[model samples]
Target: MSGVRLVMARHGETAANVQHMLDTRPPGLPLNERGHTQAAALGARLAADPVSAVHASVAVRAQQTAAPVAAAHGLDVRVVDGVHEVFCGELEGRSGRAALERFMAVYEAWWAGDLDARLPGGESARDVRDRFLPALDGILDGASGDIVLVSHGAAIRLAAAALLGDTAETRFLPNTGLVVLRPDGDGWALEHWDGAMPVAGDVTAGGTPA
Candidate 1:
């Protein structure tokens, strides 16, 4: 395993999540009660690991989700601008079956490698990759041990598929769910995807003991 393990986590359920609303603005929305619970559970689970750094999107929800984990490790949550949720543009605050359908369509295009597709007045897949991958690379370059990056679900899904590959596991990350990746030569290899942590291990490389 590589010394630098990356844990990409989706923020816990928010009121927006429950309503299926799209809220992408920075310093955006707060988490509801259920989201707090999920965040706590995720934090407790990660407390057992040797996480050295905690990075989160600038969005309020992402910072809120990362709070418990950062507190547990006595680490400050570093807000990275690039990891913020995709700017929804015309879709912001829109909710309903039709809105969701449209959102998913654009998302599917991103997964299919249509990097230029975007919502009206919004960002394209390439825009996300441009900012997100560089921020991720910066984190990896600076970290010596395990790292936790708390971000939005769609953002993580798209970036993971772009950086790793377009696959089922890379398509969606449940709220508070996480995936583990370690460097494999020039790229990254997925070690775990929304799965249980190993019951025993060093907990540094971000994988369950085999």
Candidate 2:
């Protein structure tokens, strides 16, 4: 407990999540009723965990998800633009199996070390890393204790994998799931992930969007 710990949480469920739509970008869909419940549960789960501050992406879902957690600690949800979801571009708003398949294909390529692979009219893995990692650095800069960040599924998976030097299979981070990291030298050391340390195995689910 010498240095600070960083918690990257995937936002709660949304209508876009239930319908499997590509809802990246700001002002995206808010959390559904179930999502609000999940957010509150997330807050209760972390209420006793000392949190120095709460940060979220510009997307409404991310901000909304961070609210209860922030309120629990008497803090406000600080929105950071660079942590937004990886834009789906031409794939925006589509929810068919084919759309998700194509999106997963590119994302898996990134986990397989193809950071240059770009989504169809969307962002490259490298593009996500560039913005996401720096934003995390700024959050952790001169901080202590724990910091909570609520973000999207794919973006969290992509950025977390890079930060932990992991190439694990590209599975979506379930709603409110946390990826914990601690400052290790100039980089990071994976402390906890999905309730365990980082693993190399693949975890499959419905091909979900970021």
Candidate 3:
């Protein structure tokens, strides 16, 4: 516990996410209705915590996702471009299942620990790690208490894998899921991971005050 406590959470579901489409960047599609609900629930859950700073990817979805929690804590959301999603390039708006199947071969290679394998015109795990790890390091360098990071699914997974010394598959996270990490000397310690919102309550939504 010599370093900062990082709470990493993925953005809630988007229209593209619910439709199984790939969304790499912004002006990304907005969160669908279910996504709104998820965001609200997540905000409610995090509202009880003491968050010093809230950072999110510049992507619209992530910014939208970070809104509620940041507002609840009276903290502004800092857009960290370095923490954006893995660039999917050609696969940007393709259907998720199709993208998965189309890139299955390449994905398998990457998942098998290649780390440098990239999908057609897309970023490799190593590419994402390069951009994201430094941003993460910067956060830990400045942090004194809990900090929430809202980012994409793939980037989150890879970072968690790197932090936890786990395989890519073992580190994958679902949309809007929460993953907690505490610093331990040169590395991090996994605290808790709740990838889904709690089943009860009236979760609030949007960047607007509720």
TM-score for each model: 0.88, 0.90, 0.86
Candidate 2, residue 39: how far the Cα is off, in Å = 0.4
RMSD of each: 8.0, 3.1, 6.8
| The 10-residue segment with the lowest total lDDT in model 2 | 195-204
Off by over 4 Å in 3: 1-3, 166-171, 196-210
Superior candidate under TM-score, 1 versus 3:
1
The CA lDDT at 11 in model 3 is: 87
How many angstroms is residue 27 displaced in model 1 relative to the true structure, after the best TM-score fit?
Answer: 1.6
Best by TM-score: 2
Global local distance difference test of model 1: 0.78
User: Taking the tens digit of each residue's C-alpha lDDT, what string does model 2 give over 62-165?
Assistant: 88999999999999999997898888888899886777778778876776788899888889989988999899889877888899999887788788778767
Candidate 3 accuracy as lDDT? 0.73
Q: List the residue pairs that clash in candidate 3.
A: 20-96
Give the per-residue Cα lDDT of candidate 1 at 181.
84
Instruction: Report the alpha-carbon TM-score of model 3 versus the true structure.
Output: 0.86
